[model samples]
Target: MVVEAKNTTSPHNMNQVDVNSDDRRDEQVPLLLQYWQAVSRYRIGIACIVLGTIALGIIVTLLMTPYYTATSRIEINRNQDKVTNVEGLEAEDVGQNLEFYQTQYALLEARSLADRVVRSENLATGDAFFQTFNVDPDENGIISGSDSRQSSEDRRRRFELAIRLLLDNVSISPVRGSSLVDVSFRSPDPQLSASIANAWVAQFVDSNLDRRFDSTIDARKFLEERLAQLRARLEDSERRLVRYADNKEIVTLSTTRDAEGSTVGGDTLISSNLAALNKALTDATADRIAAQAQADQNGLNKDAIENPAINGMRQKRAEIASEYAKILVQFEPEYPTAKALERQISDLDESIEKEELRMRTGALTRYSEALKRERNLQNQVAQLKSKFSGERQDTIQYNIFQREVDTNRQLYNGLLQRYKEIGVAGVGSNNIAVVDPALAPEQPSSPRILLNMALAMLMGLGLAGAYVVVSEQIDQTIKDPSDLKNRLNLAPLGSVPDMRKDDIISMLQDKKSVAWEAYISIQTSLSFLTSHGAPRSFLMTSTRPNEGKSTSAFALAAVLSSTNRKVLLIDGDMRNPSLHQMIDQKNVQGLSNYLSGDDDIDNLIQKMPDQGFWVMTAGPIPPNAAELLSSPRIKKLFDHLEEKFDCVIVDAPPVLGLADIPLLANAVEGVIYTIEAGGVKVRGIESALRRVRSSHATIFGAIITKVKSSGTGYGYGYDYQYSYGQQDPLPAPSA
Candidate 1:
């Protein structure tokens, strides 16, 4: 073994240098390569596709069924009873159709009509229809699959059930604003459907008429009772009012005439009395005022003047003054002053008072005048009012009797008219006649065959979509190159692409196929990814075992050898050694024995016969694989291999939980991580790669494994909708 100087970190800045010995585990090149190799090695999946397609086709063919159907139409109209040929019959009874249409529709639901349909059609005979339905008839003539009824009643019920089922299948609706109703039905048998529909119409007309007549009879009876009650009430009201008027002496209670007459009479009487009293009071007051003034001036009592005493004195003074005026004409004032005043004055006053005795009798005379006139007028008014009282009472009684007679006559006439009408049998009715009847359907209204089937297909597609959604949610798998490109943000190299094993093998054996030419093209991509042909040591591995790292590396080495490069293949997986098994070199001392210093360099080197490829296998399973790969000796081996070969390929152990690959990977030039299809948990692959990175290894981009011919571009045959045996033959590769 050549002793190569180790790269060192000098802590003391002296030649006494200590080395790291690559404490980091090498990248698991073998597992990554295995995964990628397994990806391309998907023979089992093609078999699965062919098998699944066949199975799916068979299942779909067996489960699907064919269906068939029948259809018909009728228009319904409302019937008019007491139909008048007169023009504007409809306009005359406006809004009458609205009421009749609704009521007729309700009457169509009558149980009696339903019964008639059942009885007439013998709809209870579904049992007898077994033969027509292709049902096996029993010894008792009942259908084989149907349950037997217990009695006639049960039979009728069963019949009704069948009718209702058929009826539900029928549809009846008015067509727009027209009086026409469209009746339709759907059934398996077209003729039976039409017959039942026509029968339903006939039955509907009969049933409608029966119901109308019955309703009108009841309504007429009720109206008769109402008319009787109203007549009696009106008569009783008239009689009571009449008797009340007769008893109250409320003659006519003429608010207008009587009110005016009473108003005028009351005003005249009140005014006359008030005026006479006012005049008497005024006269008496004037007389008293004069007497008071006189008494005050002459110093005599005013009441005495008001009475006859004052009047007499005033009269005596008047006579004396007159006599003095005569005497003073002849005599002088001094001589007559005594004679004219004193002589016979008392006798003269007596004569004068006696002369006007009637006028000066008393003040009672003035007061008595008003009293007498008021009394006389009052008596006259009393006499006039009394005279009218009896006449008013008589008028009231007569009016009462006349009103009673009038009311009774009116009520009697009303009753008599009604009685006469009834006697003559003049029947009246408020019931609206059916202008149109609800007819039975001529065809089934539901389960429209083509439409329903199309709907069913739609439902099936929806169900399929839901199933895919739910299934996709449950499945966990690495999907495609897009998953890497889009989700993982990794650069995607072109695919290695799956091909038929037969074509691949033939192309490889003959060295003459378009596919074989494509393999050469992959070599060009490899050169591009390998960075301008820089000779570098590579460690290959996947997340776990059985990925095709070894095969890909072998193939890559072979392809490189085709280009005349010296490609050395080293099996670095100490845990499981399969490459050595592939190369058929077992128990031949190589890496493990050489690392323990069991053999020298020239003695340990092995060679392959066919390709003259240098092949190295894991010499023995080591307990401390991680430590051994990270030892100084392994670094020496890498240095030697780097000098000896154009490209060194070390097939390493899986990086998952194993340090052997990561330790070895640090010594390599680059690492290629491999991934398997629908295998290796994503996090697990990431973790494995992380381990490779932490091992201080440089990495080539990842390779996605398991490119199935059916699932990828290589499966181009599927694009042609292949019937059977239509595959194109393989041709030779271009020179």
Candidate 2:
């Protein structure tokens, strides 16, 4: 039977250890390192893809026919150089430079220009032309049979084909921010490429000149027709104007002309006379006003009062009065001297009055004469104005005829001038000029080795990256311990490095082996799984068989035994027992016999003296394993073993396609899931976990087994290392 040792560490102390280590060993790893590790896993496949792509590129490059490219640079001016001072018919606006250059570039690639190049080179008749382009004339509907009509049609087709070939080979590239352009042609023959490139530019220049000359000729013809019409219209207008003026006796004395030499206004003879009479009438009116004012004042005017004779008499009278006054003062009142002085004064006064009267009469006569003169002048002015008004009425028609004549004359002169200019300008000047004539290239341009290689490399890398992403998505295996939490939402217990090739039983016995140390870590983790520290009894199972669950059970048992605890490992896989075979022990009687009501647990249990653990293997294959495991005897068997041993580990069958694991899981305190790295897919493990969880059994955690030393073996991010002393690195196990 099993003898249980005293529990040296209390459950509380064990729980503390478990709690301290409960935090997952999830270290922050560099993303680049993880990516590199993932890529490294598929390095061989990526290398094959890349190398194959590059090899294909090389083969394609070799098979491709060599083609030569010849480039001829040209300068296409927006406006042609003027040969003469006269402007051309087509005026160039500075704002339309973009449109002009675009047009020029388009013309360079024009089908007409290509045809001109083909005809000029006689490429349609030349076999070398068709051969260079790898075109068979007979196969391209260009066959010239004996039928004349068919032959003519074939010739036409061949000509069109040559034009198309020329155009296809030609490329026009314009230099940015400048008037420079490059005309290039590619062909198998270097000389042909050069010839075609040079010919393309030359033909474009010639076609441009022809188009300009044709347009100028058309403009000259149009202008000549317009000039003739305008000339006849002008003559008719001038004749009508002259006849109207003659019939109305409206002779133009003068005329006004604008800056453009067009008639603006005119003056006639009647208008001139009216102007002169108007000036004279104004002068007469002024004189009459002055004379009338003097007459009305009755000689009060200064000029009338200051008459020479009148002024002299007043002075003499004053002298006489003075003498009389002096004599009266000295002599008697009625003295003869006083009387004589008075008579002299009266005579002077009478002389002054006479002079004044004569002056007033002269003023009145002058006023009357001035008024008459003003009236006469006014009458003459009125007559002249009436005549001028009549002339103006007649001049309205004359002015209309005159304006018509002026417009016709202007049009005639303009057309004549433009016609003369077009005649002188001829075809004008060519805007396009070859800057650098094409030369026969020494090297081929296409099938570039380095360029093709680079492109192939890029393509290869793109495909490789896609493959990596797709494989990562398609692969649903548990590659790393993180997959446990990420995919299944289960905590990771510990990872055991793969020791399948090495003696796994010997490694479990040797404490220095990595496998033994990994199990010890799992044992430590299991201790902290619950508040009571490791469950008294736990079931170890996997999604599928051969996932190292049996080995894990043995390893865990050995690890617990090393801690001086009695561990009982039961092979619960009665359907297919593996623990007995793994430990090289006889399986005559085991759990199957105990569950079959043998009532002898001691006889069924065997002690492994080397591993310091007791094992109960699946002794016999039972036809009804699920039913037997479901029996109450299985629960009673685990209950009894719990008291006999410090820890009980049941290695159950795979959870999938079997009801035994769930039944055995209920008989244990918890389930310890053992998953082989990259073995079972995530969905299978999840399905198995679902079945195990349906039993209401506590899942302690999952143990990822068979992990390679290289981080890529599990998931690329897992970097767990287990080294014993100073040993050389182990070789990675084959998948």
C-alpha TM-scores of all predictions: 0.45, 0.71
44-143: candidate 2 lDDT, tens digit per residue: 8899889988998999999999999999999977666777877766766842657777888788888999889988998887567887887866565564
How does each model score on lDDT?
A: 0.54, 0.80
Structure candidate 2, residue pairs in collision: 18-528, 479-714, 479-715
Off by over 4 Å in 2: 1-38, 94-96, 140-150, 246-250, 269-399, 426-428, 465-538, 548-570, 575-590, 598-627, 640-649, 669-677, 682-717, 720-735
Among the numbered candidates, top TM-score falls to 2
Candidate 1, residue 217: lDDT: 60
Per residue, candidate 1 scores C-alpha lDDT tens digits across 79-134 of: 33334232211233543558766655554555566678778877666564333333
Best model number under lDDT: 2
